[model samples]
Target: MTNKDKSHLCWTIAFSVGLLFSGRAAQATLPIELEVAMEPGSSLTAPQEWTRILGKMNLSRVRLRSIRSTDQPSVTHVQVGKSTRYRVLAILSHRDELILPKKHFRMQDRRKLQTYFEQLPNETQRNASPRGRFDLTEKQFRRLFTELSQPVSFATEGKISSEVLHQLQKKLTLPVVQTPRSSVLLELSLRGELQGLSTGTALAIVLRQHGLMLQPEITRDNSMQLTLATYDSQGDAWPVGWKPEKSIRLIAPQMFEQLTLEATNITFAEVLSQLKPRLKVPIVLDHWILTQREIVPDQISVKLARRKTFLKGALNRLASQARLATEIRIDELGQPFIWVTQFGKDSPRATQ
Candidate 1:
């Protein structure tokens, strides 16, 4: 062989030998055991302590290839690729107990695994990674390994591996509500009105509000339940003091339902504000809305002239209220006016 070819072959041989030794070392970490103290409803206490132990194990040079969470409460299983045919590490209990079979794992294997997690695509390795930042979590990582010997995926049918579920849970931010019950739990939220009205009435009101006349097809009661936010315990903003502008008749069942629907979905604040448009103190009103509908959409052309008139009018009104002398100047639209002060001796000067 040529000199270059020989050198390349030597380098390949050295790399392969190094990898073999590395795998052997990683395989040495296995068969770990842990004892956990259970808290009612809570998986485990002292999770932070377990994290610290994991940090230390990583420092000791142990390498972990995969990790998985178990159905057993307060338990996580870790796999060391080359440790043994059945090589696994278990973390358990609220007490954060760390145990292992003799000669199962060397600290070096843990260290290598920690390094691997730190370099992952998502920042799942960090304990304090904020929600919504990454697509996965540490809990999911452990569950991923316990299933298939392959990578995580959703296509697999029939009983899904716990790992895939964990990843999906992370991605969707599904609240993990574990009761004393043995099976997994899930919850969904409903968004319209429910508490404010009866089922039939609520449906009718929603239809009316949406500008749709109530029909038999839509007359049926909605199965969805609306969840309301709890008010502050102090009762500073209680609803007792509210003064609604208009009250609609609710004599019939359908009418009762419609009123309730409007009550819950319609904001009192927004409705009140809309009713008193002049309350904005500086609304840009157009004489056109009262006179011409056709030219209303083209408000942009009159905007600057209208704005000048608005300001002048405001100043004139303010001067009259404050009992101050003022002369006003306005542009095209009879709106805002510019305020000018006439001196006893000199020319009148405009006050901008």
Candidate 2:
């Protein structure tokens, strides 16, 4: 054969082989689109069923290797390969029957799952449990679902006062207690409609306007209670004038026993202030003692020779000079508080 013919033949073979491989690659990457007539109301009841159905769906490019249903109802363990779209579609197709088991619905992207859950019907959500049903009461579940799933979208003209806000909260079925001290009477000029925003988000916007927030408290009956309160920057929202004895008892010994002193000519009050942030715990001076003595914390110079000393020992040594003693007190919530009182006065002692 002539060199020119042989060259042409080689080029033709190479082109054909290239086309074959390209076709194979395209076919491998293409998604399998199925048009099955799924039974109405038919759903995969368990993780095994989900796995089997996904396998039969010819998702060769994707893998749904395993599904674990035995975990918490809000969590699902799904082992999947690179294709997230198929997995999301499969889960959504059987969303009503599949217990997602995840605290947050997440797919290929974080926001996709959030958007999906936001659009889920209340009935579908109630049924989207691994156990096939929610254990909470209808009212409880409704409250939770509304808070989690519903987006807040409302615009109001004029100023929104605390009273008006309280009324609005009632309209949303959120319970409010009208306490004389608990009234958050800040007026806000709010004007914006939230789109696809959770109830918590809506409440946060309203609360931020008034420098307040919602906090959960345990009632005397051991039931959960939601309260509107002043926003604490430090995130310490203990009851007013309340101490934390239980927490202090549990924490003080560990914190103070290892306390090391290295102050150089700093006032006792300054020392306390420095210790306060370092300890990362709550410590308050006794108001009665401060009022009675009219002593300034910054004025009282504290001289502690650099030494690693236990908190109790350091406090005892400094107490005489500062005219103050330390005590752990309990609050209404059974949490502990550290109180610095007059050294000689009758005061509560730390729990052993």
Candidate 3:
């Protein structure tokens, strides 16, 4: 058995934020606990590879220690008997071993590692958008992903917010938080019927409609819950989908099936409606940007010249004319969907 109180580290960067050695009990809540276990046969002292790992992190808010294993005590790790758990174990393990198996921990990933020490739960938090430090460690999320991916067959369309959450919580065996603070989201009517999507994907899509998300939080005493929240620009919001396991061509061969086509002065909405039946996935618009630009799908006109091309090529030409962009996104379960948004950069893909 392993002690939960202390953190183990394979990284021994020069501690900058007055970092203490791994012996003192935590006096107050610190940043998220990180367990950077040394890979098998790796050295306890700095290695050339792990040293570069330190440079990759934005360590201003993070604390670190040099310890050999989980049993070793360190100030930067969690305390025994403390309710809170380590944000993640095997921090610098390199292999995701999760949905993103091929991924190397990136600089962007550092945001998810910290528990956002300053943004602890507060009653006042409800009045504002649900922005706080992300508490779900990568390992924790991977364990939960498979269940989130499997679809629960039902219509969450007309159900009120609270009841929908209750059913979801019962199914997943995890807390689904909708505190009084975020009451505005409760009792609000769902804009459209949700069918044929997994539990997590369905919930994420609904929340995104209102700029909210189901961010995981590990409360004290090793308890865990997924909270409904709105994140600040910097906070890592969990995503509705993962990268498709199969290549785009393999996943949707119809997208590449060639055909001669010409579209003249057709509204974007008409084009999508005509194409919707041909593809297996739904084509969704970026309503947020559309509202911002006061551009309606039916109002924008697209013109494409006669040419032999794939469905993707034809859509790209139409999307460009409508000031939109397109990409393939898969749900946690590897179900692909087509996303159409204003012509601009894509948001970071959420894979929780």
Candidate 4:
């Protein structure tokens, strides 16, 4: 018998003993009495089927309650004395009926389930997390945000949309899904390059060219995923990018720098093309607004009296006359640009 073997055995014994006692201590976390309210139209099976897993997770005395679908949110209204009770907002799994936040979890994997359950937030801090139509846990969303902020370069390289989609699937960490694969999105061979842009920003631009939008949704238990879907004017979708953290004045000083301007009988499009190089940022038109309003930039004339003003100031007057709005927004990578959109909406056209 070696002294080294004895030492290893002693450490293993200590760890086993510690884990056993810790599990016992964790047993009092919540009252055994809990209710699993099945929201209306939820595909989940009878709540009684959850008994075995709930028992394994130490939630034994769970009751079932059927609910009616309503415009109001489904929040459990239970009182557990002076202590706070967690309001969990969960979606049932379509395949195999396992609850999410339980990654690759099988009913037989009780030890792993117990370990994960034990690591959850303490009773007081376990509040419900919901935002917008699609929601991810706060911790999960933060992780997704951090990953999207990484800078990357992407080029179409004459590949069809389907090929491009496959390429994106390979490059991104999240699973990419394109539903009903549009003939245009699948067949159109796009040509463009987005260099030194955040992954999310680059993807949004690339997808826009195909008339599709990049939507991050909660599907997998471990991570939020990306979906390529047709743009919906009424639906809530992810933004093409975000407003820069830095002030607009600092990020695009060139656009704000004073310049003397005089234009007589020149079309707005001509002026924009001439000023594009000076702005040092891309000037993008909301195609939706232009197409819907039947606005042709070349046909709209601009006549400005000689004055000392910045590019954005002049642009504001021109956009206002055409019933358009100009906003400076940043991409996920913090690159500033001018976004021209329809005037009626208070927010950017790209966002909800």
- The parts of candidate 3 lying over 4 Å away from their true place are 1-139, 156-167, 343-346, 349-352
Best by lDDT: 4
For model 2, how does the per-residue alpha-carbon lDDT over 105-191 read when each residue is reduced to its tens digit?
A: 312234543344333323233444432112444565445445434443454334464634654565454455444434534454543
Instruction: Write candidate 3's Cα lDDT for 1-352 as tens digits.
Output: 1232222333324243224323322433543444343333333333334334433332223333342455332222334575433343333332321111123444345444232322322211221233334644555666667668767477766677656666666778777777564557656655444567677777776766665667777665445678888734465556656567678999888899888888887898898888888766866555555666677889988888899999998998898888877888777767778877664433454332
Report the lDDT tens digits of candidate 4 across residue range 29-128.
6433333334333333323345445555664233334322532222343566875443433322323343434354445666775665454433223334
Better of 2 and 4 by lDDT: 4
Which regions of candidate 1 fall more than 4 Å away from where they truly are? Answer: 1-3, 22-352
- Report every candidate's CA lDDT: 0.27, 0.45, 0.57, 0.59
The segments of candidate 2 whose C-alpha lies over 4 angstroms from its true place after superposition are: 1-249, 343-352
Q: What's the C-alpha lDDT at position 211 in model 2?
A: 51
TM-scores for candidates 1 onward, in order: 0.15, 0.30, 0.58, 0.58
Q: By TM-score, is 1 or 2 better?
A: 2
For residues 142-194, what per-residue lDDT tens digits would candidate 1 score against the true structure?
23222211222233222222332344335322233222221221121111222
TM-score result, candidate 4: 0.58
